[model samples]
Target: MAKPGVRPLTGWLFVAPCALVFAVFTLWPMLFNGWLAFQDYFIAERVAAWNDFANFVTLYKSATFRLSITNSLLMLLTVPIIQAGALGLALLVHRKLPGIAFFRATFYLPVVITVSIAAIVWRYVFHYDGMLNWLLTAIGVFEPGHGPQWLDQHVPALIAVMLFAFWKNVGYYMVLYLVGLAAIPRELTEAAVLDGAGPRARFIHITLPMLAPVIVLCTLLSTIAALKTFQEVLTLTGGSGETVTALYFVYNMAFSGFNFGAAGAAALLFTLVCLAVALVQVRVMGRHNPFRRPA
Candidate 1:
């Protein structure tokens, strides 16, 4: 009964359920959120009404919103450093050293742990007068009470949050790099070696060139993660939110301040900013992405 050189409509039927679910959960929320972004929300009115661009104008005047944007951008700056570190770790572990699998597993195990659980563990480690400061004191870096304030002070607070983000995600990115490194043909590296290319030259020309896609993927992932930071800020900074991120700002605007209209606009702006960054990343990396063949 099926047409020649064509399958039945069974393929569409098979995927219908997943498509419906995606529509209900993902598509609906996004459409509704986009609609709400232009509206004023009021408990008195018990509904939303379009207020045009008033919310956006008010948001631009908010100092806290400005600060949050600065903080988010600061976290975004860490993506390159973390990605480089992950690449180095992956390259080191990609070797056929004895028990390398064990080492890989150990490094990746932390990434599987729940974020809340990891945050709790880091809380104690980063607490004032905690284990880290104790070690610092013992090493004669500072007196017992003079260690860096990982949570309290403004500058160090941002640094502490960035450090936690790096620690949690570096292993995840490293695993991706490991896969890329493994896929590289041994012949290429060997050929470079025979051409009198030293270790640095070989990596610069052969290994790194091939891993461009992985690097771009990890950088974009980390940048988005940094932009949307929330749990780490809450747990590490005790929700005082000294280094408030854009997501946290939206949350506080909606829940704490009860400024639903401004919050919606902030959320929309944040999304647009993230989208712009992602587009920029794609454009920059698309030039040399090895996954694409010349047309």
Candidate 2:
């Protein structure tokens, strides 16, 4: 016979399989990576030895790692501009105006395209004989044969990457803003209008405040995406340019150098920095989140 209080245990029986899979795949790998960070694993002959804090010391002292961190932080600065572009598009299409649906669909088309594919498409555009250079030359913005080399330098490559990132992600963020805008009760805007509020005033005092939670969420997501940039850099610059981001460093160490131990250490440290940023997002925005109950 089944025990009297067996129902709770039965539910656990159903959950047990998923829990086991998670432990095996997620938890085990994390623990293993943590251990690897402390080991002195050499690619030569696949030798391994115990070494505590050696990776950390080398990583912290390396100038390349420092430069990578700087580049990552610099890239992160573009998130707000991306949000602004997204917000503008969302506002334009959130209403039931004529052709609004078409505009919304057009803006969102880029989001559905794969990043690698889009980057490849853009790579041609950024080429020396690309359309951008040709257009600039025609417009007298540059000499016919001496246009700027976008992928040849650090600043230009990072700028190209930022522009691509903004173009790629803005539409996705716009859809999120549209959802938040839809959830906003119409009555609030109507009341503000009846009270003689101007368009700018209503937006400043009402719409912006109402979109706070969504904006914060987008900021967090975009910040994470920006800081962990890799594939875009790989496809856009062929990983040969002067731009080497933190994730690119981790990738290079693991694959090119075959220093998995140092890579794991760098990955762990990068995760903690990202964790701190996420914690700040929650701490600062959790109370203002519309989903939260009033205290």
Candidate 3:
């Protein structure tokens, strides 16, 4: 008989197919990207003799690459804004207010909407002569005939895309916070209250500590998502802004310019940067995880 807590040969056999698929699809591509970083591999020409990091050198020398890095870094700053807003929404909805379920559903509704649809809807809302400018005009902020170029300009386009992304994703994060809040032990809060602790004190000391795991998970996930921001930027700005991100640059390099090797190198570098950020986050916050004892 198989030893308890150990997998049998049959179980290993069962997992072999999944392991093979993962290795082929995910592992091989990653390895290939690393290889491509060293040489020039064109679409029609295919892979060439290794150039010893020439592609990487070229990537670093490009002005577009620098702009892409700055754009990605700036976009990442929105994560905390989103997480804090979501947490506030969670705290509000987690209360025993009337129609709480309805409110919770309303909060999550945006996440269910397709990104394409959201982008299109936002397109109209932020149009040069659209409802936003109309409201601004009505309030005398601007003349009826005047409106900001929401998508035509670089900065405004970036801001508009970020705003839409935040609105669409905040609900999903709010739901995650709600789940975390619900799982927190009610007795702990009651005990704090009994000890003459008010809401603010209890939240600061007890609630946040208990919710540390959830916060870490959300932070890491949001960081990755922000790093990989492509669809919204593509749909909203079409990679035309001065704020084109790293992924968009990769997309353009590979598809538009047909420079497969350089794109692959850029992608590999982006992956390394993302991994570094994730490691830094873990180093900073990993000790606070509830599942691990604090040193």
Candidate 4:
């Protein structure tokens, strides 16, 4: 007899193809990136040689690397903003209100749009003479000929990137929250209502505690996405603003600067940071999960 928890041969067969692809593509690339981190590879030279801590030294000393890391961390500050927007929107639509489906689809428009294409559209809108400036001017928020340079400057550029990130991901997380809200037994809320618990009180005491796992998952996804932001910065600011994120640093080093070894090193560090965040999330949320064992 087979073990109680083990799946039969059919299940293993179903998973084999995807496992093969993962081994070939994802695992191979990750292993290569790890190997490359410890080697010196110049574009002119076809052969890579063993490098001893040189890549790490270069990565640590590079001011651009520091700035990119800072920008990526700064972008992480928007996770709360995204949570607030997505959660509120999810709560609004989780119930079957009039035209709820339309509102959900409209909110999800940004996620469906291609990143490159959306970046271009946003770049046009955020330009000095774009729709945003026009609206502000019309509303008398800006003096004539005093439109803010949303992309040309450092602070405004970062702000624009954060806003775009929030907009693009809000609906995605909202859907996740909606799923969580659905899984919560309706009777619990009904009982609370019958017991004279107000809507706000019910939400504060019952809804939130039940959705803990989903909130953790959303936070982990948003934080990692913010850390790996690249395409938005590329098209939005021509990849030349204070908004250069960590992933862009890797791209610039490998392709533009022809320093694949150093890029690999930085990539490894970024991977470590991502892994740490995920592990912490799992540890924290596992406590609330029914499947988790008592501590």
Give the top-scoring candidate (TM-score). 3
Local accuracy of candidate 2 as per-residue lDDT tens digits, 1-295: 5679777779789999999999999999889889889887877777778789999898999887877777888888789999999999999898898988899999999999998899989988888899889998999999889987888888888888898888889999999999999988999999999999999999899899999988988998899899988878888996656678889998998898888889889888888887887676667776775446798
Clashing pairs in 2: none
Q: Which digits, one per residue and each the tens of the lDDT, describe model 1 over residues 152-233? A: 8788788888888888888999999999998999999999888899999989998888998778788877888888898888
Please provide, for model 4 over 49-114, each residue's C-alpha lDDT reduced to its tens digit, 9 standing for 90 to 100. Answer: 998889999988988888888898898888889998999999999888899999989998899999
| Number of residue pairs clashing in candidate 3, backbone atoms closer than 3 angstroms, sequence gap of 3 or more or interchain | 0
The backbone clash count of each candidate, in order, is: 0, 0, 0, 0
- lDDT of model 3 at position 84: 96
Q: What stretches of model 1 exceed 4 Å from their correct place?
A: 1-19, 43-45, 289-294
- The worst-scoring run of ten residues by lDDT in candidate 1 lies at 283-292
Tell me the TM-score of model 3: 0.90
lDDT over C-alpha atoms for residue 196 of model 3: 100
Considering only N, C-alpha and C atoms within 3 Å, which residue pairs clash in candidate 4?
none
Candidates 3 and 4: which is better by TM-score?
Answer: 3
Better of 1 and 4 by lDDT: 4
- Kindly report which residue pairs in candidate 1 clash with one another: none
lDDT tens string, model 3, 207-276? 8888888898888778888888888888877876576899999999989887777888899989888888
Q: How high is the CA lDDT of each candidate model?
A: 0.84, 0.87, 0.86, 0.87
